[model samples]
Target: MKKEIKKIVSYSSFLALILMSVLACSSSEDSSSEEADSDDGEEAVTELHAAFAAFNSDAVTAILSDDGTEVYIETTGYPDHTSVYWETDNALYIDEPDVSKTTQDTYIGGGQGEAASFTVDATPDLTGATVATQLNTIGIAVSGASIFNDQEGAGDLDQAAGSLDWAGAHKGPGVYHYHLEPTPITSDDDSLVGILLDGVFIYGRQCNYTGGTPTDLDASGGHTSVTQYTDGVEEYHYHIINEVYAAGNYAYQPAYVLFAGPFQGY
Candidate 1:
């Protein structure tokens, strides 16, 4: 009887050990699941904060028009040569210089032209209703080389243009998009130089619209060919002027449309 009781006790001990092992594995799995959930929640919160910060900052401002059309101006280089307006249709319009003037002196050099007068409604219309509404239809364009030209250590303009990061954040959340000289557009030059926009950077030159089929415009200007992007969307982003005036140099005409998001005004 004594031997039999001992054997029974030993079996009970083995059963208890097995149960304890199973419980330990279950606890470990639950802990791992909880940790993953916590990490996902934190990431979501970070993204929300970044978006909200951009919305509330002064980098973007509303310019309500009398005709029920809303206009928002990014004053990065406001009133200066680089000043531009983002309309509801996502079209970016540069203030044309007056045409009466025979010689317009620009930072680069003197060019024969006239400054276009400011009108309520003009060609290349930039008026829009909301930020996201415009962005959804129209894209974005960037003009101006003041920042790129003034940058230090900028190599050849063409090479710099190719390396620009269009989504880089700038002061007041403005993105850099033109004049890729002085540094690669995707590099931290803008941020290091005290020009950051929510940690996002902009493209140096205007990204050409490649949504449609590729087209070739004869050598009237030069070797011109329009290639579409991977998705085959239809929109003209910029013009690549290669071999202009037989100089063998290349220059890009930057233009874009703003479509959507909190960039809209009241």
Candidate 2:
């Protein structure tokens, strides 16, 4: 999907910059300024990453920031795939006899629905310390739904695993989200899953560069490598961790954790 661009023009009164003479300038000044910028700068980007094209166009739209230093992602929150979470009257609704939904009365687009919007840095601040993901929406999935962490409420997700649908998702009394590897978006392959809060793209269990599971991932399941969309350039990204998360009768037994993180790209 093509992002709607937000253009910005600075009309500062101090418009002209004075150039220093070559003999008057010190080499240390340039080196010091460059180091400072690298440590804290929010780098500007010209365009959205190519992998965003894989998102469901009908339910999601990305808007580039006016200064080209951020991307605002908006989603209707309703997934394109069929799920028991949808209302019976909805065309995408489907019945899963074996699955236990969070609530029979609760459905997608009920009160708040799944609609959401958030801004992320155009370039991830990898130089800073890693930031841990919070309880709410950590990222937006390719299916146009939210991506949640491995925990539920104040505890782990094992107790609620039975309610997950065939694709490993459920409406947890709020918006619909995925807690495990969403099969509709990615199975065990090297598919693009979604972009996270820190502006890093995440993939499936396999790494596109190695054509297999990546062994050098940090605690956040991230590593610098050439993704399918990076045009052969090595860029840092996350993957759905390969370890199986066992829960009670989950349709996809030994489900993979989508991302349980102290995000490296923050």
Tell me, by TM-score, which candidate is best. 2
Question: What is the Cα-based lDDT of residue 97 in candidate 1?
Answer: 29
What is the C-alpha lDDT profile of model 1 across 1-266, one tens digit per residue?
99999999999999999999989988988998898876533221111211112221322332433443222323233211222222223333333322111112231111311111111111112123322211110212222221322121333333322222232111112323333222322221111111111111122222334222224422211112232221443321222222211212222223121111222211
- Local accuracy of candidate 2 as per-residue lDDT tens digits, 1-266: 12222221122212322223442355567877888987656789889889889999998899888778999999998888999989999998999988888889889999566887889998888988999888879999989999998888888888888898877889977889998999988889999999999999999999999999999999999999999898999999999999988666786577888888989886
**What's the residue-level lDDT of 3 in candidate 2?**
27
lDDT of each: 0.26, 0.86
